[model samples]
Structure formats: C-alpha cells, structure tokens
Target: MNNNSNLSSNNNKILNTIDTVMGVKEEKEINQQQEYPPLNGQKLLIYVMGTLAQIGFMTLTLWLINLGFKQLLEYNLDVRINTIIVSLFWIFFTIRSRLFSPLDNTRSRRQYDQVIRPKWAPPAFVFPIVWISIGVLRVVSSYLVWQELNQNFLALPLIIFTIHLALGDTWNTIFTVEGRYGLAVPVVIIGPLLSSFVLAYVYGQILPLAGWLIFPSCIWLMVASVLVINIWQLNQKD
Candidate 1:
C-alpha cells in the first residue's frame, strides 16, 4: 500500500512539471504573435504610396536646387547670397520634416501619448520645439560651412551634412510614419546619432563655430537614442 502511494505521488509530480513547461511554451508563443501582428494590406499600400511621393518630390527639389546653386556660383553674389542660402536650407528642412511627417499632427500626438515612454521622456510638445531649435542650428551651421568652402556645393563636409540630413529624415519616416519601434532603435543610433558626431567633427575641422553649433544637435541625438531604446523595450508587447 505504501509503495503504491509513493509511486502515484511521483507520477503526479511528473505530470505537473510537464504541464508547467507546456504552459510556459504556449505563453511564449502568444507573446511572439502579439509582438508582430499580421500586416494590414491597406496600411502597407498607403505607406508605399506616401513613400514614393516623398521620394519623387525630394529628388526633384534637390535637382532644381543643384542647378540653381551652379548658376549662382557663376555670378559674384555678395554677402546677401549667404542669406538666400540660409533661407533655402530652412525651407528645405521645413518641407522635408513638416510636409512629409509632421510631428505635431493629431495622429502623431495621439500615438506619442499612447506610448509607454520613460519617466525622463519629455512631453510631446517639447519635441517640436526642440526640433525647431535644432533646425535653426543646422541651417546656421550649414550656411557657415558653405561660406567657409567658398559656396562649393560639392564639398566633402557639405556632402556629409546632406547625408546626415537624409538619415535624420529616414529615422523620422521609420519611427513616426511606419511605427517601427524596434527598427528605429538601430536606425537612430547608426543613422542620425553617428552622422551627427561625424558631421560635428568634420565641420569642426573646417570651422570651429560651425562645429559648436552642431555639437548641441549631437548631444540631443544621444538623448533621443536613449529615449528610443527605452520606448522600444517598454512597449515591446504593445
């Protein structure tokens, strides 16, 4: 009788262990499924159309600006041309950020509010204000660099600056527009953060004042990188 009782107890323990293991496996599967829900066809179509439109507009704008800059170089424009260049930079960045993916839009604000941000994360209103200041810095730094380079559009520093701007816009598209939080982690670091440091260094080599202006942007990007990583981890199951 005692032997039979012990055998039954052991068997029950083994069954319970198996149940626990199976439960854990099933829960993991559910979590994985929740992490990546099935793609919505309509959403994908909209994203594709929007991306194509943005690309076409950007390409045309750059081409026309390039042609205009070349013509301007032929003429001996005075210091006033620097003002025009600054205005152009401001317009280009404004259109690139606002027209394509306005961060202050109702949908964007709603999405940002719904996210599980870190305690250190600033309010949604802070983002647009910060970016506006950064944009001003970018415009000023680029103008200074252009003046230092004798308005050479093809200078290495300017090329890197342009590439950096493109990377920042790419990050905005991925993070804000596409809502790819996990992907945006590496994109922000590898794309904008890295490029900002590089631009700062390169610009510093050319002009100290230009570098100083961009240094704040680099610091801001670092803070943004941390915020992005925290947001991704906090909302992984969302």
Candidate 2:
C-alpha cells in the first residue's frame, strides 16, 4: 500500500515538472493573446489535395502547349541543351512562386506590415511582362519533352514529379510553419527530386544505348519506394 502511494506521488511530481518546463497552462497569463488552434491535419490535407489537383491539371495543359511547340520546332536541338533551358526556367519559376503565392503564407493573422518586394522593381507594368516571360519558358519545356520523346509517355513522368513537388511543399510548409509534426519533410521531398534526375538519366539518356526496356520499370520502383517511406512516416504520426 505504501509503495503504491509513493509511486503515484513520484509520477505526479514528474508530470508537474514536465508541464512547468513546457510552459503549458491556462491562457490568461500570456501578455498578448495568440488565438490559434492546433494544426488540424485532416483540414490541411483537404486544402493540399485541392491545390495539388490544380497543379496537375495546369501541368497537363502546359504539356499540350509543348506538344504544339515540338511539331513546329522539330527535335533538332540536342537533349542536353533542352535540359539546360528547362533547368533555368525552373529556377525562375521557383523564385516567382516564393515571391508571389498568397497560399504560401504563414501565421493566422495577416502581417501585411512584413510583406515587401525588392527595391529593383521594374516599371509600373513590369509584373505582367515578367509573368509572360516565365510562361514562355514553361511552354518551351513541355514542347521540348514532347518533341524529344516520341510517345506521350513523357507527360506521365512529368505529372508524377510535379504532384510530388506540389504535395511536398504544401504539407511541409503548412505544418512545419505551424510547428506541427512535419518530420523529415525536406528529406522526403528532396529524395524524389533526385530520383527524377536519376530516372531521366537511366531512361531518357542511357536506355537507348543500353538496349533495355527495364529502365522505365526501375525508375517507377524508385518513385514507389519514396512514396512508401513517406506514407509510412506520415502514418507513424511523428
């Protein structure tokens, strides 16, 4: 009876100590009120899905533009040269997305005071011109891929990778920014990006010389591995 009582007392003391260290308590003591709920994952996921579908459809329509470009340009340009152009455009797009996306925000309240663009803003009408320039790069990438690859198969891989990118940033940004369990999100996203390059290497650049049909299958296996691992981590709830 005495041992049981002692153990109960010790456990209570430990819990109190932990709670004190963590600063968890009734809300009234806080100097400035921060009315925020815990990150509800289910809600975040629904928003993410909507965003992902938009990105997927946008990418597909963009790809059709590429197909048209390929018919006009012909596949005369070297694949490596095309890849270089795609890389540069991707960099520009990434920068623009970071700069402009209203969905790419954090905090519950609008901190309009913190939002500011760079000093080297072009003329008053520069925004539309800048946007159109980046749009051309995206269309050209689609066209190059369609021209270089005979089948429409290139669209499938591009869609998969873009979905992966869209999901990674959405989940990562939404949760991590809100102090939620966004474990290894960067690693998860980066692993797939690297896999895309590997797939391009094995299938697009090498398989023809190797005289093999297994490259596509192998590339898919890598993608599956990434998805499985990430899903497992998400399910583990940490």
Candidate 3:
C-alpha cells in the first residue's frame, strides 16, 4: 500500500511540472505576437495612394498657375476682377491644401494664448513680404520656362521648392489643426532646413538671382520655427 501511494504522488508531481512548462510556452507565444503583429498590406497601399495623390495635386496647382499667367498676358481678365480672382483663388487653394487649421478652430485653442506669445513672431508686414518673395520665385520659374533655359537642370530646385512648401504647410496643419505642437516643432525646423539647402542648390546650379530672392524667406522660416519652439514650451501642460 505504501509503495502504491508513493508512485501516485510522483505521478501527480510530474503532471504539475508538465502543466507549468506548457503555461510558460503559451505566455511566451502571446508576448511574441503582441510585440510583432502581422504587417498588413493595406498600410502600404494607403501610403502609396497618399503620396500619389499629393504629387498629382501639386502638379495640377503648378499647371493652373501657369495657365492663369498665360491668360493674364493676353489681357483676358479685367484688372480689378483679376486681382480679386487671384487673391481668392490662392486663399481657397491654400485652405484646401491644408496649410492651416480653420481660423475659428485655431482661435478656440485658448491655451495658445494663455502664455505670452514670443515677441519675434512674424509681424503683419512680414507676411506680405514673404508672399511677395514667393511670387517672385514663381515668376522667375515661369520666366525660365518661357526662356527655354536649362529647365531639365532647374527641375531639381523647383521640385525641392515644392517639397519645402508642402512640408511647411503640413507642419502648420499639424500644429494648428491637430494641435500636435510637440511634433510640429521639429517639423518647423526641418522644413526651413530643407528650404535653406534647396536655396543653396539653386544658388550653385540654378539661377543665382532667384536664390538671392528667396533667401529672406528662408530666414523668416527659421525665425518662425524658433517662435513655434517657444509656443510649444509654453503650452507643455496641454
């Protein structure tokens, strides 16, 4: 009877050991699955689609601008109406392109105003200057196309300029629209750095005059980025 009881006790202990080992293996597998989930093809497809959409949209904008200039040269539009149309068109286009959050929505963010704004934030006058500089650059680009001057070589700087604009506007949307100021701070810096580098490229390989014209805008962007950093710091509680 004693020997039989001893054998049963040993069998029970062995079963317990087997159960514990299986439980640990199952837990490890669960953790592995959590750490490394399956990569869905849908994400890749969405990324590709988004990139293609942005590229198509920007190219269309360039085409429309060129068309508008052609019409202007032909005196097809009344002077006052043309000015109004161009202003409204650009305003709507920039809004639709998500350059900024809705004015009302951005204004609703009381936290942005709770702290004193940086003194160096671009003043009202600076905006017109920046816009004028951008317009000059666009005109220069159009002139280059009209003159049939090394467009193939100039293409890189133009592409870079487009990218810089997109990134800067996207950063604005992220900060003002999404209220992701922390993430936007880095983006603000990055956008200007990209613009500066592209300006250097334009100076070296493209039109030196065009490069000089855009340099002030680059400085403005850097100043804007610094202001953004200050804003982020002030609103950290959010």
Give the per-residue lDDT of model 3 (tens digit) for 87-114.
Answer: 5544444333432212212211233434
lDDT of 1: 0.67
RMSD (CA, Å), candidate 3 to true, equals 24.4
Tens digit of lDDT per residue, candidate 2, span 1-238? 9999999999767655543432223234433433345546775565556555646654764476467546635866776776565555444433233222224423221211122323432332332333344334333443345445553523554455354445434543443233233333443445444544543444344234221232333454355345434543544433
> How many clashes show up in model 1?
0
Could you tell which candidate, 1 or 2, scores higher by lDDT?
1
Model 2 regions lying over 4 Å from their true place:
1-36, 67-102, 105-154, 182-238
lDDT of 1 by residue, 1-238 (tens): 9999999998767654543322212233322211334446774464445544544555455556667877876787785875677577554654344344322111144446668999989987566556666877888887788779876555688767756766676677567645678877887999889999999999999999999999999999999999999999999921
Where's the lowest-lDDT run of ten residues in candidate 3?
99-108
TM-score of each: 0.66, 0.38, 0.52
Task: Please report the candidate that would top TM-score against the real structure.
Answer: 1
Q: Pick the winner on TM-score between candidates 1 and 2.
A: 1
Clash count of each predicted structure: 0, 2, 0
Q: What C-alpha lDDT do the candidate models reach, one value each? A: 0.67, 0.43, 0.51
